[model samples]
Target: MLHTLPHAEADFRALVRKVTMPKPTTTRRLTTEAGAPIADNQNSATAGVGGPLLLQDQHLLEKLARFNRERIPERVVHARGSGAYGYFEVTDDVTGFTRADFLSAVGRRTDLFIRFSTVADNLGGPDAARDPRGFAVKFYTEEGNYDLVGNNTPVFFIKDPLKFPDFIHSQKRDPFTGKQEPDNVWDFWAHSPEATHQITWLMGDRGIPASYRHMNGYGSHTYQWTNAAGEAFFVKYHFKTNQGIRCLDAAQGAELSGKDPNSHQTDLLQSIERGVYPSWTLYVQIMPAAEAADYRFNPFDLTKVWPHADHPLQRVGRLVLDRNPDNVFAEVEQSAFSPNNFVPGIGPSPDKMLQGRLFAYADAHRYRLGVNHTQLPVNAPKATVADNYGRDGLMASNAYDRHAKNYEPNSYSGPAQSDQPLSAPLALTGHTGTHAAPAHAKDDDFFQAGELYRLMSEDEKNRLVANIAGGLAQVSRDDVVEKNLAHFHAADPEYGKRVEAAVHELRED
Candidate 1:
C-alpha cells in the first residue's frame, strides 16, 4: 500500500538549489606537521601497482606515526571532566584579607577557566554517578596562572596526604574482579574513622549534584592570605552557586546514567552556548593567624570544618562561566590546574593534604603532558615570565630563554631576583622520626559527624540511611559491613539502627 508522493516543481527546485549551491573555497592545501605537501594521500607509495610499499613515503610514515601516538595518559583521579572559559570579578573589596592582585580592587576582573568533574569515574563513564565532583579554577591573573583546586564539599575523607593513594585505590576497581568492590571501600572506611564526616555527606542528598551549576564548590584546605600590612589570615574558599542548589535522588541519578551518561557535560555546554551563563559568588572564611594555634580542632585538618559561627564568611567576588571550549580535547583536556600555582599574596598552609597536592599535581602533569605542558596555549600564563633558567624540554614551543645567559646569577644581563621579601616562613620544630598527626586535646572524629546527622531533616536522614545501606548491602563480607555500621553507630545510634535494618532487608531480598 506504500506509495511515493509527487513533489512540486518549486519544492524540488528549492531542494536542488540548496544541495547544488557552490561551497566556500579556501587556498590552503593539506600538509604534514612539518609543512610538506601530501600529493598522493589516497594511495600508498609502491614499487609497482601491486608490489610492496616503498619505505621513502614520508607522508604515509608521518601520518601513521602521528596517529599511533595521539592518545595521552589519563589522570589517576578526576579522569572525567567538563570545562569552560570565564572571569572572576571582585564585587567587594577584600584588601583586608589578602593582597592577591586579582582581589586587589572592587570591580576588577581576571580571566579564568573552571573545570568540573567526577573524582573516580573514567573518561566515558556516567557523569551522574554517586561521587564527589572536582571544582577547580585556574585564574589567568597578572602575576601568573593561579589555580584554586578544590572539591564541591567543604571537607574531605582524609587529612593526611600519605593515605590518599590507598584511599583512591580502595574506591576504584579491584585488580582481580575488574569492578569496584564495596568490601574494599567499607574496609578502609571502617578503619579510618576520620573519614566519617565526609562519608555522611557523600551518602546525603547533595552527593549526586543536579549539574555542575547547581552544587557549591569549596577550597577544602586551609590557606594563608597575607594583607598589605604583611599580617596573615587562614582562609577557606566557598563558591556558592547563583543557581539554587539542586540534587538528583539515587533513583533519578541511576536512571539518567542509562538514559544519558553525559548529562552534566551536555547541560553545561548547552547552557553556555544558549547564553544562559552559570555563576558562583566567592566567599572566604577568615581566621586570625594567632587563633589557628588555639582553635578547638586542628585548623588545617581536611577532615574538619571551621564552624561558621566562629569564623564567618565574607563576600569577595563573583565567578561567571560564559564560554564553552572550541575544541573539548585541545582546550579542556589540556587545561591543567595545580595547588602550587599561588600568587604573591597567597601561600600554602600547614594542611597536610594541601602540602601533598602542591607536589603531586605538578609531577602528574609532567608525566601525562610532557615536561613543557605549560607551554600549551590553554595552560600558558597570561603574564610575562621574567625568569630565564628554563631552556629546552620535550615539545618546547616557547624559547624566551633563548639568550645565551640562560643560567641565573650571571653578569650578562640575565634576570635578577626581586628585591621584595618572600612570604613569611612557616615555623617547624617537630622531630625527624615518624610521628602521629598533631592532636588537639579534645579531638574526636565522631562528634562532627553526629552533629551533622542531628542537623539533617527527617527526609534527608532517611535518604542518607538508604544511600549508605545500599552500598553496604553490596559488601560480601559481613564483618566489614558490621564494623562500618559500628562506626555509624558511634556517630549516631538512630543512623546506625536505620542502616542496619535497611541492610538486613536488602540481604533478605
Candidate 2:
C-alpha cells in the first residue's frame, strides 16, 4: 500500500484492516517454500534406531536436497533487492522513435515487475549502506517480455564489459579473509581511474537513499529504439521519482542500517499498502540512428551519458509500482529477468556490456533456476506464447506436443519462422577484431567520472571524500591511500584534497 499511497490516513487503515491477509492456504498442505509438503517441520523423520542406517528413506533425502539448494546463487552483483508489481502507462507519442508496444499508444497499461537493489552487498546486508541502487524492470507487453536492467546513477564505472567481473570482485569480499578489502578496491580504482565517477557517486550523500521510493532510476547505458517504420533512434531511459530525490548522511545511514536492515524494503511495501503508489515519470532521450556514428563520444560506451542538452529526455510514459507480491518465493524470489528478453520494437545498442548481458543473464538463470525458469508465473510472458516446440525439462507443466514434430523443418506446417517476429536488422560495419577483449579508447573511461565529481554540491563533495577516505584510510599502507587519492585528484583536485585530509586523520589515529 505504501508504494501507491496518497498519504497516511485513517480511511486507508480501515481498508487495510479489511484486506490484510493471513498466510495463504492452497490445495496442497504445509510444504517448504519450494512447495514440498512438510511432513515434519517439528522434527526430521529420522531412522528407527536414530543410528542413520536407512538409505531407503526418500523424505529425508528430499529434506537434505531442499536444504542444500535453499540458496539460488545470490546474484553475482545486485545481490540484495526488493521487488513489486504494477503497471506502465504510456503518456506520450513515442511510436515515432520506437515501436515498442508498451509505448505504442496512450492509455495502454502493461504489467510490470520491478526489482530495486543495492549494487554491492550480500542478500542480508544493510539496506541503507552507501552503494548504488539497481533499478531493473520487466515489462510484460503484447509482443513479449522487456527487461530494462539499470542503476540509479546515469553512468557506470567502466565503458567495457571486459572489466566487469574484475570490478565486481574488487567490490566483493576478499576470498582469503571473507571481508571487504580496502586494498582490493583502492588498487582497482588507482589502476582504472574510470572508477572515479562511480566512486564519487558511491561516497556522496546520494549513496544512501532515504528509501528506494525517494530515489530516481536510470538506464545507465545508452540503448537504441526503433519504430515500426524501420527507423532507429538512440535512447536512454530515466525514471524521475514523483516523491522527489531524498537521501541520508553517513551517520544517519549507519544508524538506520543497524536499526532496520530492511529499511528500504519496508518503506516501499508500506507505501504501496497505504495506496501512496510511488511513481516515476518515464522519459527517454532519443537520437537519430544516423547521428550515432558522428557523436563526439562513443554512443555505445557504458560509462557515459548523452548530455541532456544534446538529447533531452522526451517523456514517454509513467512507471508506477503499486502492488506487493502475494508470495515472495513464487513471485519475487523465482523471478528471472534479462536484458536479452526484448520484444521486437525495442533492442540493444553495440554497448559491449549490454551485449554480454544478453547471453550472461539468461545463462546465469539457467544455472540458478534450471532451463524452465520462465515457466514460473513471475517470469512467464502474459502475451501470446508460441512455445509449442519448447520441449520438456524439469518441472515441465503442459506437455508441449504429443504428436507434432519437436524438431524443426517438418512438412506438417509446424511452427515455422515468421517473416520478422524476432528482431530488427541493426547494421554492423566495423572490422571484426579478436573477441578476447575489445580495444579501449582515449575517452573510454575517465572524463565522465571527473565531470560527475565536479557536478556535486559542496557538502556532497565533502562527504564523498570523507566516506571514501574513511574506508580507504584503513588500508595501513600510505602508498595505497596516496595511490587511490591520485586517481581522485585526476578526477578533480578538490576531490583529491578532501579525501587526503580524511586519510590523514586516520593515519594520525
Q: Please state the error at residue 237 of candidate 2 in Å.
A: 0.5
lDDT by residue (1-509, candidate 1, tens digit) is 11243444555575577568664396777888898776556678775445699999988999899899877888889999999999999999889878888889999999998899999867888999999999999999998889999999999999889999999999998999998888989989988899999999999999999999999999999999988898888999999999999999999999999999999999999999999999999999999788887788898999888889988889999999999989888888887889998888899999989999999999999999988888888898876563547767898766564556767788888777777543445768967986667888556788789889999999999999999989999888888888888888988898888989999899889
lDDT of 2 by residue, 288-398 (tens): 988877787777777677888888878988899989999876777678879988787778888887888889889888887888888888898886574657767877776
- The most accurate candidate by TM-score is 1
Query: In each prediction, how many residue pairs overlap at the backbone (N, C-alpha, C within less than 3 A)?
Result: 0, 22
How far is each candidate from the true structure, as Cα RMSD in Å?
Answer: 7.9, 11.4
Question: Residue 243, candidate 1: how far off, in angstroms?
Answer: 0.8
The best candidate in terms of lDDT? 1
Native RMSD of candidate 2 (Å): 11.4
